[model samples]
Every structure is written in structure tokens, then in C-alpha cells.
Target chain A: MEKIKIEICVGTTCFVMGASSIQALEFEIPEDLIGKIEVTESRCMEFCKDHKDGHHKGPFVKINGEVMADATYDKVLDKVRAIIKKKEEN
Target chain B: MKEELFIEIGSAYTNKAGQDICGDTIHFKKIEDEMRTITVLSDGLGSGVKANILANMTSHMALKFVESNMDLLRSSEVMMDALPICQIRKISYSTFTIVDSNINGKTKIIEMDNPPFVFIRNQKEQVIKNRTLTSPKWSERSLHISQITTLLDDRIIFFSDGITQAGIGTKKYPLGWRREGCKKFTLSLIKKHPNISAHDLANEIIEEAKRKEPNNISGDDMSCAVVYFRKPRKLLLLSGPPYDMNKDKEYAEMVSLYQGKTAICGGTTANIIERELCLDCEIDKTSFDKKIPCASIMEGVDLVTEGILTLTEVYRLLKHNIELKNDNAATRLTKLLINSDNIDFVIGTQINNAHQDPNLPVELEIRRNIIKKIVRILKENYLKEITIKYI
Candidate 1:
């Protein structure tokens, strides 16, 4: 199966804004999703620091090119599941 | 249970007999009668036999002095003078950090020039608070005395550069354990096995550090003195004005006399303080917690930044005090500052028109306030009587 790419921002700004937990997202995803999702740790996507909607919408994790805010465990998990399900359908 | 304080020490170094004959030595003694636990960590120059001798000698000398009930300055001086200097090396120095307090469950730390000690409680690590202790005759290098009383159940960690130098993750710098990694590692251990012994815990940390380093460098001989108290330690705070050149000259000369440990924070300031103090210093970019103005003087150790040098010594002093620990936190912080016998009279300086508030820039001020809260808590619980002199 083609892996659904997941990128995590490990920059200072993201790191300070709870990216510490984002770094652990790979482990939080279920075992079956591990094969479907490729969690890539990146050094400063730079875009995470770009202000959006008048808020510091950073510390983000991009799943299959879809950007998500407050990229917490549950939220990221949901995104990972939807991507995997869609990949299976395709 | 006997309800008596018991201490078991396990020390190893590069010496001939797996003993620290002349390296950094941490001495712990429990005075059951006084309910006081005396813990001392002293760092001598170099490693191996000679260093072992110096460190061992320091520990012994400090023990004798403390046991004799002599004043802290007198004790440190006696130990410094007693060191056997090598004719060829021409340098045999040792820095000290000592804690003495009654067990009514109160713990006070009397620190000279040693690395900042950390206390672990509720699985979180916090550096012990200290103040500057000065003696006129020995105040070069700023002989400082810091007394801190803390509640028991808090585990106080005293280490030489050896432990801190343990590399971790990709960044191969000492103090590189990366607070989060170290914190997580420590917390995980306790959480996994609540009954783990302190000895085991210490070994785990050392082993982990060794494993993470690429060269598997045993690194410097590692040693840590950890005191796990069951209750809060009492405290006394004492501080005086910043360094007064007129009066500080003698103190500076005194610090010059002893071989003590020195820690410098921020990049550029570490360079200058190392040169001025004639002591080996390690600079850490990620070391200082960004909350307060950076503290330049810790225990007997001085911290400075590039900005301070350009601005002026007085500005550095004011900015530093404001940033690192707040003016009010001086109470408990005085306990940690008493690391050097040479540090006397804190000389605080800053350029300010009466009309202007000398507080740091807004962002830096926020950091300062966070540090302030921590310092305030330390002062409320421990420390007393530290003076501030603005130049």
C-alpha cells in the first residue's frame, strides 16, 4: 500500500508550542496505521511560523498535504485514519 | 524503622583503587543528634590519581572544618591552603558546594563554587536556590555562601562536570542531555518502578549518558551526591550589596587563592569570565531557562552576556539580577550564591535615568517574571539576608 505521508515540524517555534508531543505522534498511531502512514520529522518547515487566521496556527502536522491546527494526538489520529481509509478506497 | 538518618556512599573514579583519590568528591554525613544532614561536593582539577588526591583532600578538609564547627569561609580556606600543589602543573584547585541543616526536616545548602545543584521532586527537576556569601579576605572570584532550607522528600542532586557533560541525542554538548530528554528519562524510570533505589537511579542516568554518546566516552570521572529528604528543609536568606571594587579587591584576591569550580552561562560572557577568573568554564546556549533576566552570579559563579560587556558592568549587573532571579527572589537565592569565599558585596549596576524604568525589554521581561515566580517560591521557603548594590 502507498504510504500516506505525515510531516511533523520540529522547529524552535513549534517545539515551544507543544511540538514536543507532536514528535511522539508516530507511536500514538495504531499499529495497522504505522504501515500506511510515513511520519517524517522535519527541521523547520518555516510555514508553521507563518501566521494564519490572526492566530499562531503552528506546531502543525500536515497529513497528505492537508494542514491541521492544534495537531494533538486525537486530532492527528483522526486525520491519519481518514487518509488511510481513503487510500484503501482509492 | 529506627527513624535515624542513614547514608551510604558509592564513589568511583580514575584512581588506582576505583576510589576518587584526587578527583571531585561529594561527602555526606548525617548528624543524627542535630537532625542535620551535611552533604558536600568538591571538584578538583584534572582526573586520575592526582585529581583524586585533591578532591579527597578537599572532602576530608571540608569534613574536618564542618565537624569542628568552624565558619564556612574559615573551613574553605583551610582546605584550600592544605592542598598539595604540583610543582610541574603549578595548579591544584578545587571548588566546593556544601549543604548543612538540622533534620527537624529542614535542609539548607551552603554553596561555594560548584555547578548548580538540581532537586528532583514529583518527577520534575529544579535547580537549588542560593545567595552570594562573601568574606572580605577571600572575596576574589567572589566567595559566596548560599543557604537553602527545603522540605524533605525532595531529592537534591549534586554533580561535578562529569555527569552534566554526558552527551545525549544528536547534539553532542555537555548539558546536552536536553532538559526534556533527561526529565523524561528520569520521570519514566520512577514511574516505571516506584521503588527504585537512589543508587540504582544514579547508575541508570550515568549508563544512559554513556550509551547515548558516540565515543562511549566514559567522559570525565562521573560523581553525584543525591540527598532524598522526607520533609521540607528550613532556610535562611542573607545577601549584601553587589561587588564594591574598593572592598571587593580583597575578596577577589581570596577567590584567586583557591582552585574552585566555575560555571558560566550565555556564550560570550562565559568567555570573559573564564579569562578573568582563570578557571575552566563551559558555555551552554540552551542552559538558562528563558523566564528571568539571566542570572550572572550563581553561588560563587558569575554569569554575563555579550550585551552586558558592551553596555557596562553596572548595566550587566542590573540586567542580570532582573533577568535571572528577581530582586525579591534574592532571599532564597542567597543560599545558592554562597559558592565562593572570594565573592563579597554584590555590585549591581545599570544605566537608567530616574524617569525610566530599567526593566528589560518586554519579551525578556516576561521571561524574567517566570523566573521571578520560581525564585519567589524559593525565597518564601528558604534563604535570607542577601544584599543588592546597583552600580
Candidate 2:
């Protein structure tokens, strides 16, 4: 199975805004997407706290290093689905 | 340290005044991490407020001394010398009964100025041989102190003088309720409800003591504490649908490996389990109420019920002890939980959007919140080991 690496920032700022939900992605994955995704929590994505431009804020998820800003439930879901769908098509 | 123990303490005291305060004090503390349990019940010298204070002080000191690994009899001696003596009776102000038990089934009971403790094994009173030790302060004052290795299903009941002294001047019995009477009543009750929980049994005995009272006015403060040794009955509860259908096999395997009773909650989750395990579920047509859905039965599953509503009802019944018949799945589930010693909840993370339907009369709650609330209540009130694992 081809795996899509999913990175989630679990730093203090990100966690307060709801990044812990990202860690539960393993339980939230759909049937077709279960084993095909490799989820990891990065201490800091350098997007939430230290980003100078500030386009990407806290509670962020990065699929293969592509940052998703304000990674709410729907936002994270969309990013994960995109990666999993791409792998399925391949 | 891992052995299961059930401790129940109940008290009934009649005050000279109509106030609710009973002079007798019952205190129980369990250091689960340390595998030690201390139960102290003290009856003060007189019936009212002064007696209450003395009882409280004795029990408080008794627990502290026992926790520090002081010898039981020696500790009693210290307590006797420390407390103020009664001018007329020439004895300690408060009389106490202490039951200190360790995880290895070693139980030490020390009683000073109270009645002898009763040991019941298999519905019959077991005669316990205790050594009479004299108080250091007063050589004439001797008390009963016993040590025993508790066997599984053994029950030790200790009470204040008020219990055996019930109905002293009544026509029913010119003499008070004696040790023999107490034993007979306890044996009869145990015979009728053999598997009664500790809380229920303690309550029954205390209520009986009150019944034996003349005109419901107890002569003294009454308290009863019981310790029952039994195997832990574990229950596994599965609720909600798995987020990934592919993980159903893993979930089913986990359920199959559990050593205790299995309960499947939610229609979708049950169907998923049934599909993965290739089991058949026969739905019960009988409805307990309209609020909750009908129950179903799978071959190996102990309980099967509809999702959120049944769970909500179970949570409500546990939180607020309402009267409900056990004919339906929800109430039966409640009964099973109350009787069990340990419970593990395997919850699925998939949100049921349908539960949030606008037409529903009750407020919609997510499964995680419901599970958390139920776990808290079961742990705090029922004293059960509850663990939650997400799928």
C-alpha cells in the first residue's frame, strides 16, 4: 500500500486550539484510507507560532509538508482526503 | 495488591432530639495505590452531641494510627490513655471498632468497649477466636482483637451497641436484640438475597436494626460496616460505529478476547460487530418504552441495544437512581453494571450526525461526552474500575 505522510503540529499553541484531535486521526480514517496514511505529530510545524508572514496560524496540519492553515475538523479532513484520494488514483 | 475487595458501611442512629445528626460516626478510607483499606466506626459514650464528637475523634485517630503501621492492640491502648475517661463509667469517652485489611486478605479487627465482631462465611456465622487484651491505662479494661486470613466470599460485620440492644424494653422481646438475634436476622437476609451487593446488604441490616427499635426511637447510635471478598466481574461495553470499517475485524477480535461479559451499544456498531463476527442478531419486538429503542440479542453478546437513546437512558438511571424495570435492554444494562466490579468501554469515534436531528425532543449529545459522564459516575458513586479505549 502506498502511504501518504500526514504531519500535525502538537505544540502548546496548536494543542490549545484543538490539535489533539489530529492525533486521533488514526481512529477517524475511513476504511479505504486506514493503512494508506502515516500520521505523525511534529513538535512544531514552524507555521503556527514562528511564521513571520503569519498566513498559517496555530492548529495546523501539513500533508507531505504542505501546510493547511487553521486546521479545524473540516480543514484537516479535507487535506487528509486529498492525500488519500491521490494515493488511491495512483 | 490486585485482588478485588468490596467494602460497604452503613449506619442507623436515633437521636434524643429530632435532628438528623446521629452520634455514631462511620468512616472508610481506601488507599488503592497502597492496597490498604481502613474502616473505623466509633460510638461515643452518651447519645447526643458530646458523644458524636468523641466518636468522631476516636475514629479519626484510629485511622491515622493504623495508616502509620502501628500495632492494632497497642494503638488501642494509646487511644484509651489519650482520650478523657468517663467519670462514672471509668472508661474511654468513645468506643470504637476498627477493621484494617490489606490486599493479601489479611484482616485485623480491634474493638474497644463495643460488641464482639461477627464473621459470616457461606450464610452461617463463623465463631472467631479473639484474644482479650487489657488497656494500658486501665488494666481492668480488656477488649477483643482478632486477626484472620480472609477467604473469598467471607463477610465480616461490625456494629455499635445499638444494633444488639434494639427493642430492649419492648413487648416483642423483653430482652434486647442479642448477638444471637443479630446473627439470625443476618443469616436469614443473606439466605434470601445471596448475591446482594455490599451497599444493599449493609443498608438492609441497618434498616432491620431500625425496625427492631421500639417506636423507631433507637436507644443508642447504630452503625454497621461489612467487607466482602469476591472475584471481580468485568464487563466490556462497545458503543458507536468504528471510524474505519476496515478496523472492524480488530475490534471484533478485541471483543472476543475479553474475559467478561460483552455489551454492544448502538445499532450500527452492533451490526458491524455481527457482520465481522458472522453472528446473527435477533431483535426483540417487546419495547420497554418509546424513548429508547428495542433490544436485540446476538449469540455471544451479553447485551445488545440501540445506540444513543439507550445509552442516554442508562446514563440517566445511573446518575439519578430512578425506578425502572429491567425488562428492557437499557435497564438490564444498568443492572449488569451495578452488579459488576469492573467495566471497560470501547467507544468508536465516528460522529452520528443523525443524533443531532432537529426533530428530536432531547438535547443531542456526542458519544464521547456520554461515555465520559458514565465512567465518572460509575467510578465515583459505584466504586467500579472503569477504563475507556477509543477505536
Candidate 3:
């Protein structure tokens, strides 16, 4: 199976907002998804500013290049689960 | 949460004339004791020396008043009273942009009759809450001031009228590069070079304004400044050799464990790092950058320089009274220091017999004293994060 890449922002803002806990996410991964997922820590995604089209989101996690703003442990987990299920079905 | 360590400032300016005079004045002061940083950019009523003095005084007064914790509106009112106004124009002699940022990341920006400052976040425009303050005096001027807690990667970009007036009469755009154009251009630049230092970003904006004109001459003095916030950048500097010969691996191990950039000073120290880390230290003597000894390269180390000469030069540069830019090992080290939010000095206490030899042409201050002085200048003078460790 192809690996699923997740980039978590640990820059000052995100870290303060609790992205620091994202690093510990890897240790808690379920057995089924252990090797199938790859988690990386980025110092800063540098996206604290609002976009020209919309507002900026914080505590972001990028899964396969898609940004999930205001990330949470359960929210991100559900996102990964859904994506994995879709990939399996295909 | 602990306060963010320090803020980095970058400024660039182009005068209305190719000559020595510029009507715009920009000044920045960091007060470590008070835990506040004040920056002011003032544009005088008109161009030339007369305007220069007015703008200079305005910036100076603004910093003094704001740093003392005066209410900004009250302080600005007093400031307008102090400066002479142009009676015909019915405006104060200077229009200003003032930024007051505290250690806690709370920032207040006050602007009077200039282009609206651009504050960006997450690759989009931040909608700042601006309140209006009208001058009570006969002067009919109005100001916009906003207060917001800044986040990492948040940028405050302000510029003089030269940018607002660029390409006004040119066939390209009779309206010139207005605030909207400026914002769009900045957003594009920020998108392309997200990690650019404030200095480079400011210069890019000023240059873009110059390009808008076919004849390439700005109608007024143009200046731009950027304030960027980020997580503290940590640098570990290893110099000299450990007092205990046995701790050579320990020093190398510390560098190996450091997450930030690493700088190795002295040939012997470089050899120590090379030996412990099992990496090759190669000296590139090809460059004719004659100002100092040629720098070296080693795996896992960001910068490598000869001991005394380079350290002495870096100390002098850190103690440098004037603000200027240069390309050398010392300057490179300074750039790294300026860019970093904090620096850790890992000192080796060994005293070299050769450096003590009177026959040598160089003057060497005790390495500890040099490091201490560098730390003082960084903390007290530049208000940067710095600490020292002796081995």
C-alpha cells in the first residue's frame, strides 16, 4: 500500500495552539495504520496569514497536501480513516 | 506562556532624488528592560532636507513617548502639537506610521494619512479592527490605530507615499500603484518567498515600485518596512576546545544533539568536530573575499571559520556602531545571529600556547571575554535571546 503523508505544523503559533501534541500522535496510532501512515513535523507551514480569498486557519495538519485547519486528535484520525477506507475501496 | 523572544525588523528606502537627501525617516528601538519594541516611519509634509528634519524629529518623539507607556492617542495628540504644521496644507509637518510591540506579542499600529499598512496571515489578508482618532487641534487630520495579538509568520508591512504614487502619470497606469496594487504585489511576493528576511522583502517592494515607472524615477521618496514574527531560532556555536581533553566527544555530542544551526570556530575545534563526528572539514581558499580568512565547510555544520581572526572580527562587527551590510564570515555570522531568535554559546575553555606566543602578529582577547561581550551586545544592545555554557 502507498504511504499516507501527514505534515503537522509546529511553528510558534501552531505549537502554542496545541500542535505540539501532534508529535505524540504517531505513538498512539492504531496497529492497522502503523506502517501505512507517515507523520512528519514541520517547523512552520508559514500560513498564519489569511488568504486573499478567505480567512487563515490555525493548528493545521496537511494530509496528502490538503490543509485541515484547527486540527484535533479525533478529527485528524477520522480524516485519515476516511481516506484510507476510500483508497482501500478503489 | 513565555513571551516570544524578539522581533526582527527589515527596512528599505529610495529617495525622491538619486542624490543624498530623503524626506522620509524610519527608526527602530528595542528596550529589553521594558520588554517593548517601538518602530516609527515618518513622512514629512514635502520632500528635501526641511522635511527630513521634521520626519526625524517625529520618529524620535514617537519612540520616546510610546516606550514610556503613554496612551497612544494621547501621545499622538501631544506629538501633533509639538510639530509645526503646514498652514496652507492644513496638515501636520509629518505623517507617521508607528508600531508598538510588547514582549507578549501584543502590537498596536497607528497610522496617520499614509497608505493603509498591510497585515497578512496564512497567505491571506487579515481583517484588522481599525478605530478612528481625530486630532482635536485645528489640524483636521485623522488616524487609524489597531491592536492585535500577533502570531508567528504574521507580517506588518508599511510604506511611504512613493509607493502609492508610483506610475501615476505613466501610460502603464495613470492611477499608479495604489494600496490595492501594492497589497496584491506583496501577497504574490510573500507567496513566492515565504521565508524571506524582512530586509530582502522590503527591498523587493521598493524595487517593484521603481519598475512601475518607464523612466524608472519615483515621484516621491519611497520606503518600505516589514516586521516578521516566528518561533525563536536557536543557534549553537562551538568554539575553542574543552578544558578537559576527554570531553572532546561531549562537545561534539552536544553539537550533534542540537536541533538548530551549528557554527564551529577555530581549526582545532573544527578538527575535534570532524574527528568526533567522522566528517571531513574542507577549506575552500579559492574565493578572493580578502576581508577575513576563508570559511570552511563540514558535514552537519552551517559555518566554519578560523579561530582568532574570525572571532575577533565577529566581535567587532557585533560591536559595530553603524548599521550596514557586508558579505564575509563575520557578516555571515551576524546575519545568522540577527535571523535567529536565540543563540547558545558552547565554549571550550582550553588556552592555546601558540596564541600566547608574542611572536604571533595577531591580538587575541581571552576567548571567554570575547564570547561574553558578544552575548552582552546581543542581549542588551540587540535585545536578542542569548545564553552561554562553559565546558
DockQ of each: 0.02, 0.01, 0.01
Clashing pairs in 3: A47-B122, A48-B121, A48-B122, A49-B121, A49-B122, A50-B121, A50-B124, A51-B123, A51-B124
Q: Report the lDDT tens digits of candidate 3 across residue range B112-165.
A: 877889999887888898999876663578889899798778888999888888
The reply for model 3, stretches above 4 Å from the true place, is A1-90, B1-6, B33-35, B84-92, B103-105, B286-288, B315-328, B356-359, B376-383
> Which candidate tops lDDT?
3
> Per-residue lDDT for B262-375 in model 1, tens only?
322122223333445565543222322222222333335534322221122222333344333433112123323322212222222222111122331221222223333434
What's the i-RMS of each model? Answer: 12.4, 17.8, 20.5
Residue A43, model 3: Cα distance from true site in angstroms: 34
**lDDT (0-100) at residue B85 of candidate 3?**
72
TM-score, B chain, candidate 2? 0.75
- When sorted by lDDT, best at the front, the candidate numbers are 3, 2, 1
Ten contiguous residues minimizing lDDT sum, candidate 1 chain A: A41-50
